[model samples]
Target chain A: MTDATASLGSAKTSADALFQRKRLTAFAVPAVIIAYLAYIAIAFDVVGLAQRASGENAVILASDSWSYKTHVTRDNRRGGTTYAIEGERKGAYEDGTRPAWVSGDEDSELVIDLEDGHVVRFLPDNAVAYDVPGFGTIEAQLVDGSLNTNLSDPVPDWINLSDQRMTVTTDAGRLTMTRTRTEVFRYFPGWELFWFTLDSPYHNRSFTEIALGDRIDPDRPNISGAMSDFWNNGMWRHKDVAWAIGETILMAFLGTFGAAMIALPLAFVAAKRFSPFGALRFGMRRIFDFVRGVDALIWTVVLARAFGPGPMTGALAILITDSGTFGKIFSEALENVDEKQIEGVASTGAKPLQRYRFGVIPQIVPILLSQILYFLESNTRSATIIGAITGGGIGLMLTQAIQTQKDWEEVAYYIVLIVVMVMAMDSFSGWLRGKLIGRKD
Target chain B: MTDATLSGPTRREVDRIQDSYMAQVRRRRMYGGLTLAIFVLLMVSGFVVADDRNAGGFWDGWRQMLDFPADVVSEAWEKRANLPGLLVRYFPALMETINIAAVSTLIGAMVGLILSLLSTRGLARWPRLITVFRRFMDILRAVPEIVIALVLIFILGGGPVPAMIAIALHTAGALGKLYSEVAENADLKPVEGLASTGANWTQRMWLGVLPQVAPNFLSYTLLRFEINIRASAILGFVGAGGLGFELRNAMAWGPGRFDEAAAIFVLLFGAIVFFDQISSRYRNKLTEGQ
Candidate 1:
């Protein structure tokens, strides 16, 4: 007893002498993983990563200046807005200081808009050449202050602002508006030409207001022309983006429903416990594994080769891929059914067919239905991948938008639409899955 | 004594019945043959449609896989300058994505474990909760990883973080559902014994319940790891970065770099297979020991 106690004491001392024992690893596995992944991030340049396919076509399509004309309207009911922007081709490069259209960038074309019958056109900051409808062609520099041309010498009656704000002598009358940052008509007038040019820091604050206090400063440059151009044109830029999103939705639905047709039925025979025959079951199971092992993009690329191009390619590719996935899932569900019910049917001297119909199918229907609904939700996103490959959907449009860097606003617009779609799908699927499985959402 | 007279009528009736049955069977056989023909026709049509679309370069892309070692090693080593750029751009994104995945998986696993614990009959009178959780899992699992990524990207913006979260969210749902099934179907005798002793929820779960389902949970988590890794790689295609970004770029701009894409793809697939094999073997050993 003395030796045991002594030994225990010694052991305790030695253990204490060693490193402190940790209940949890101070350096979590996630931390290590994060570090390792950070190494990979170091290798990739997110900004440099190109989102669009820069082919010969994209290269040749490049322009010095892109002019956009637009018409805009609001939909208060849907809480949605609609507009159209038309790009007029340009020739030759222009000064970099020129006021580009709003939401213009490298990957996208010119954007424009019209609000309350007033037309606005947005051009790229680097636009060298421009095409106009009635006026032939005009070249101009980007200015910070507002200037109105072609509206007559005296500003028109519609141009009336608080008379004391500022006076502009025109053919019709003297019209003026106060230049204040808080005014809805005002945007950042001048800022450094960066990647997101024009939408930079210069618009919101008036130089006159900041420098002259209560009075308008003589040094405040007028960017009214640039602002007017942007406001008039930028509103209509979202239409193209909307169209792109619509295409993606179509691709997803067609692919998902078609794939489900094959996957759901095949899942039954694939389940080892419920299979009609061992060989059939094994074969189906193997088929599922093979299809699912590959990436969907790989499938898309493959199908694109087989089918050529267009929405059909995207649809077929998704079908082939989803089949394998749904098959395995459905089969597992089949295997999990209560065997007692199956046995009960069997003891009645019913054939396999009758037993399956009465005992197996009904019990598994909800499971299968739930699976199908989930896959449908999944396929919608996959449709976007297909779009990337075939250039047929919103993904393709997004790629274009990213490449030109001309339609960031459109990019934002499409992003909103896609989010709304996916969220809607998620909610609907959750509800449906709950209903089929007899559970709450 | 009556056998001869009865036999004569029975023979006539049997002949009439047999003749009608034979005719019906012949008609049914023709219909069956037509149906089979239609089924075959549909299969062929699907195949043809698939064929006409894209001849599928994945098989061809495999050929590029062979060029990987030479090109990757050369480019990686010889182009030392580009290496820094590549590392700078890729490593952080990769780490961010992985972190996202790890955190998500950990949280998901906990949720799954908790649900599994609650699924036991003794813990609580909430069969409805279990049922609801299971269906919630179905909804969660049904959404494609890519779709999840896309939605998250929209909500969170383009980054590795969102991709990781997306993967983790789905993993939680799937793992939770699977874990619940494992718990529900576990041997209950010990559970009953523990209950008889008046064990509390946490205690019963720790000592009586967990020991039974630990192997299953481990195996599932490992399996999910393999899946999540592949998912992480692909998330890059949607602006999430890793090997997928490289693959996308290759596809988009530089087909010549396909060798790199092929190499990365091979690595991903190999990693999955290796993890699967190791996890399965380990799991089998564990279950055996248990």
Candidate 2:
């Protein structure tokens, strides 16, 4: 009875010690994590970041993504008004034409009736008047080489006035007057010139009219003309966008399959079971490690210098990087192959090549195919990033658009297309895997 | 007469079987050959098209492939004395890069843990919303980090925050899928026992489910951490603050600054290799159960 009691006491002590350690570890891990986060917060300067972030830029990006502005400007010296969409030369209204919203002629007073009772009038002598619905009419004029505006002593916060320029901001529209010109901007919903540029005859035509009505352009039929105009729209560049999307896909395809082809033989040499010589296997493995270590970003930069910026350079970079990864994976798969299959092939008096073909290749083909297909999907995304670095494909266009800072609509368009493209590729690869591998799930 | 009749019937049967076997072999060979032909055609045509669209043709650039590397290396070698100073100066940037990866991975794994629990079949908080969560993760995973980074940079200005957020978003989506797969196979006995004790969902998950899958979750998280480091470096190249940004600055200065670029390249490679080794070692241990 004394011995049993002593043994139970020892067991309880050990169990209590185990629980104590576990509780300590559980608390310690979270404490460590919290300490690290605190350090990072100071290092990253989260406080400063919050202050530095611009709400105005976010507002611009958000508004610009789905809306466009039409610029109605009167050249002070030239004495004629020109109307343009987003101030692009391609979107300029014809000399005799104007948007339905604007009234009067270029030679006379131009009245831009911004909706919601906001009106911007371009008077003679490089003068402009903006009538805000709630506030009184504010007038500005370029006298001598400076802008002079009529306002009370304390100007409203919305109107920014100076000797060189005057800007009026309101919910309905914006107006600015400088020594050289007076401009009024009217905002509108949806992308401007997305279907057709101002030069196209079918610019404002409805789809129903285009489908049923006679030819809008005398040179061609209605359907074909509209189709060509939309496809070749200079501002949106649908044709170019299509080509870029295709180039990105091509880079991924060529890189993925090319790497698989190159890696398959190298994988064999790297696999210990296949290669009897240790030196060759070791050398091959190191080569893979080196290539992988160099990484796609560095490879892209190096190759871009040699090949110049293009899709091919991006493809080659992906090929080099993925070959290393594929080689490692394939070699691992090769190492894990069932030896009995190889023995069976050898027992048939098969040659070395035949033995490999019948024995090893069959066992690893499903693994290899699935891996390659998966890489193909992922490489599409990699190709986009690599394309940005190499100056090719949709990524190049996207970066360029973003850098311009005023083309948020185009940026939004490209982003949508990229997301759609990637998701489509993902589903495609998944479907192909199901078809080829007989669906593991 | 009886022996001759049996021989004739056996010979005919044997010939028929051999003919059918030969036909099957021919069909298989034909299919294989066709696939090979299509693949070869696609490769050749793709090369030609890519060559046509490229600013410099493949053949023209092939011979000069190693020239840039040689030039950079030679320049770097001449300024090798400054390399140590450059590396020291850039060490902080390297730390920032690693920090971005580590923090993003930590936050992403936490979010992904919740997402995986919600999406996994037996562990879902709302069974009807599983598809919604899965699709949300899919969309998140589909967006390239650079796209989000660039957009964020415009609003947030050039800094590491954009890169961190972009990488975190991607990591969450990727880890969520992997974590869900592991969670799907988790033994539900502990969960049932906890449920029987009148424990709430959160309590059951924390006390029962988490311990059962922690090892696999940790291994996957480490692997994701490794991937996120590479992603953070790449995001840096596109104006996000890190070593890649410094490398870009040095490269922009041209030949005279090659040493700085070289130092950065060395640092990046070393960091990547180091993290890869460390994470892989830990991942192996976790998967192998200590």
Candidate 3:
């Protein structure tokens, strides 16, 4: 009885110790995480980052992504006025024509109605008048090569006047005057000239008119003309975009399949069952490790230098990197194959090649195919990144557009297309996997 | 005469079966051959098109491929004495890259844990929103990190913060899917018991489910950490600050500053291989018992 009591006491002590250890761990883990996070915050300078963040740039990006601006300018010295969308030459209004919002001849005073009861008028001799809904009319002129504004002693905060430049900002638009030019910007929603530019005959036409009514362009059929105009839209460059998407897909396809083709034989050599020589197998494994260890970014940089930056370089980089991965996975799969099937095939008096083709290939094809298809989907994303580094495919276009910092709408468009492309590839791969492997899952 | 007639029918039946079997085999072979032919055709045409569009043709570049590596190696060898100093100088940048990866992985795994629980069929707090949460994860995964990184860089300026946020978003999506798959297979007994004790949804998940799946979740998170390191470095090349930014600057300096580039290359390669080995080793350990 005494011994039993002592054992029970010991059991109680042990249970207490176990609970203590668990309690300590539960607290320690969170404490360690918090400490590490604190360190990172300080190291990354979160405080400085907050200060450095640009609200104006954010506003520009956010606003530009969904809205477009049309510029109406009067050359103070050249004595002529011009109208353009986003002030781009390709979006310029045709001579003797203007947006409905702007009504007046180029040679005469032009009035721009910037909705919400805001209006801007380009007076003769490089003078401008802006009428704000809440405020009275404000006038500014370039006098003796300097901006002269007629305002009270204390100008409102909305208007910024100086000796060299006069700027007025309102919800409707902005008006700026300087010695050489007076420009009025009117903001509008939506991507302007997305379907067709002003030069296209199909611009501003109703869809029903283009599709069901009569031929809009006398030189060509309605369907073909509308198709060509949309395809060759100058501002959006739909043709170039489609080509870029195709290039990205091609990179993924060639890289994935090419890697699989090359890795199959190499994987065989690396597999212990297939290759008897220890040195060769070891060497092959190390080679795979080396290539993989080099990483794709380094491979891209190296290949881009030699191949001169294009889709081919991106594909080659992906192929080299993924072949290493495929080789490793394939060899692992090979190592797990049942030996009974091979023996059964060998009993039929088949050659070494035939035995592998019938016994080994059939066993591992499903595994290999599934892995290859999965990589194909993932590689599409990697292609976009590698393309950015090597200057090829949609990634190149994306980087170019983002670097411009003014084409946020195009950036948004490219982003949407890229997401769609990736999703489509994901579904396609899933479907193909089901078709090939019979969809066990 | 009856036996002979039966044998004659059996012989005809065998012949018919043989003919059908042969036809099936032939058709299967033809289908396989057609698929192979199409694949070959696609590969060859793709190679040709890519070669045509490249600034340098494949054949032309193939012979010269080793030249660039040779240049870098020779230059690095010539400046071998300075290699140690360069490596030391770039160590801090390497740390920054690793920090970005680690922090993003931590945050991503946490977010992914919540998302997985919310989307899992048997374990969801609200079963009606499972598809909605799943599609949300799908979209998050669909966006490439570079797209978000580039956009954030424009708003946030050049820093590691943008890279961290971009990678974390992707990691959350990827891990959420994997985690949900693991959660779907979890035993429901513990959860039901906890529920009987009047445990809340959060309590049931934390106490009943998390402990069961923590090992697999940790293993996957380690793998993601390995991937995130590479991603962070790449994002750095696109103007996010890290070793990649330094590498780009060095590359831009051309032949004179190749030693810096070489040092960066060595650092990146060593760090990647090191982390890959460590994470894979741990992952193997975690999954070995299961």
Instruction: Report the C-alpha lDDT of model 2 over B200-282, residue by residue, as the tens digit.
Output: 99998899899989999999999888788888888889999998889789878888888888999999999988888898898
lDDT of 2 at A439: 91
What DockQ, between 0 and 1, does each candidate earn?
0.08, 0.80, 0.83
Which candidate achieves the best DockQ against the true structure? 3
How does candidate 3 fare on TM-score? 0.98
Each model's backbone clash number: 90, 0, 0
Write candidate 1's Cα lDDT for B1-290 as tens digits: 67776588797998999999999999998996997798567555544443343333334433453353445456545555554454555554445444555555766687767765665454534766866665667666645455556544543446665576678777877797778777777777886788899987677777787878888898888777756765676677767665666667765654455444444545444454555568668877877875
Docking model 1 quality class: incorrect
Q: After superposition, how far is residue B137 of candidate 1 from its true place, in Å?
A: 14
Give one digit per residue, the lDDT tens place, for model 3 in B1-290.
Answer: 77786587787998899999999999999999999999999999999999998999899899989988888889999999999999999999999999999999999999898998999999999999999999999998999999999999999999999999999999999999999999999999999999999999999999999999999999999999989998999888998889888988888888878888899999999998899899989999999998
List candidate 3 stretches off by more than 4 Å.
Answer: A105-108, A152-158, B1-6
What value does the lDDT take at residue A321 in candidate 3? 93
Q: Which rank order by lDDT, best down to worst?
A: 3, 2, 1
Query: Alpha-carbon error at A86 in model 3, in Å?
Result: 1.5
